[model samples]
Target: MASPHRKGSNIEGILDVKRDKVTVSPLGLDITWGGDSRYWRIDARYVELIQVCWLEVNGSVEMKHLEKSTKYKLEFKIRMKPDAFGWNDSPVYIMAMPGKKAKCIWASVDLSRIKKSEQESSLIPPRLEFTTPGPESFHEDDRMSFGLFEIWKGRWKGGLVIEGVIISRA
Candidate 1:
């Protein structure tokens, strides 16, 4: 049960989505993330899921400050621990929406395979891409919602570590 805050850590309890680009830490998520210290390790940089049956991590960002008429990518920078389990049959999905009234876009990935690939290069983690609308299409107060979900499986899973959600120009 390590504290998610430390000296010089960029992690924030509340995210300022008004920035041009930003990273939303686990602690900044808008929803209640389940798991105690025994099942989760929260530190300055990331949140490690040691074990869990239901997974639902979610967050959102304001679209006003983002570049208008531009495409943006919302991705979860994550990796799997060597002993990760329950992901073989479970495919975690990354989902996003440009505005509150917009349709949602999603993509699925296998965490077990991601772990292998990450161990190979240890460079960039996998990212899911999504495009946003121009300023003319949405109001200034509109916000884009996004998250990683793996609840349908209903099986206990573990060993997934999440750095944060990166929102950048695509």
Candidate 2:
């Protein structure tokens, strides 16, 4: 069973859900920014993905005066350690107007660049990563906005994680 807990103005994490071949762990995330403002930033990260799963989220806020023709950009940062076989995979998705029947739009960021090699002495890099997916139109009556990165596949030699957001503004 997947159970989610809420704290204050933020939803904490999902619990009792299956991951990595039936292993259960809480997928709690710290939402650095989210609200009814003209702009929003959503971020999250995880180190495991070994099963078929999906994250479902909805908005309880309504937007008024949102400019027509405006566009929303979604970005994601996913980091993971390579499994013993050294491989990882995930898909980022954006649902137009949260929970709508429209097809999910995949983020345009290239996954091949995710595994860039950096100097060992350099600062530690954030595992999973992304910026808001971009260049899409918005309507005045479009009150709902939400985004997510589905961990479609992940297997590697060490560890893995990713982070990113859907930023909406005029």
Candidate 3:
């Protein structure tokens, strides 16, 4: 079973994107803010056709607001349900944007046998470490926007239940 998705002010990560701040698909998809100020859940119960029509998930956060000098990784905490599809044999696209210093990555997901809980969510490969630029680097503002947008080769995907994007370090 998956952990109940809820929201709390203290919850961390870019997962808690304000409704007005969400720039993902507003068409053919229902993006819901999991009834909390700190959770982003897209109520994508069904996607028409499930093809390469729309294949992008985008999000971001301010580096300055995060703990200074801390190392963190951006990951989509997802638990694949039994009916999960569109994820097999398809690679996801990830990109980090910091003043044009963007790092885009490709992620392959095999959810066919994974447990159906965020606790079962595995670490994305090619672990990318993002060190907070520290407070000194911020004079005007320092925002870091990263996302899993577009499927490799324009493949469409579906049936992905997202707990949220988690920013954490070992």
User: Pick by lDDT: which candidate is best?
Assistant: 1
Assess candidate 2 and give its TM-score to the true structure: 0.36
TM-score, predicted candidate 3 vs. hidden true structure? 0.55
Q: Order the candidates by lDDT, highest first — what do you get? A: 1, 3, 2
lDDT of 2 at 108: 31
Model 3, residue 76: displacement in angstroms? 1.0
Q: Model 2: per-residue lDDT, tens digit, 40-132?
A: 222333323332233322222222322334443333334433331233344334333422322444433333345532211111122222122
Estimate, for each residue in 1-170, the C-alpha lDDT of model 3 and write its tens digit. Answer: 53332222223332344422222221222232233223234343311222232455555555534565656666655555555566555656555554234344344445444555423555443464565554556422556666554444545454555545555552
Regions of model 2 farther than 4 Å from truth: 1-66, 82-94, 98-104, 107-113, 116-143, 149-160, 168-170
Q: Against the true structure, what is each candidate's TM-score?
A: 0.78, 0.36, 0.55
**Top-scoring candidate (TM-score):** 1
Candidate 1 lDDT over 39-134, as tens digits, reads 677775677787777777777766765766677777777777777789887988888887887889888877767744333322122556666776
Shift in Å, residue 1, candidate 2: 9.0
The Cα local distance difference test for each model comes to: 0.69, 0.30, 0.45
Clashing residue pairs in candidate 3 (N, C-alpha, C atoms within 3 angstroms): 56-150
Query: How many times do residue backbones clash in model 2?
Result: 39
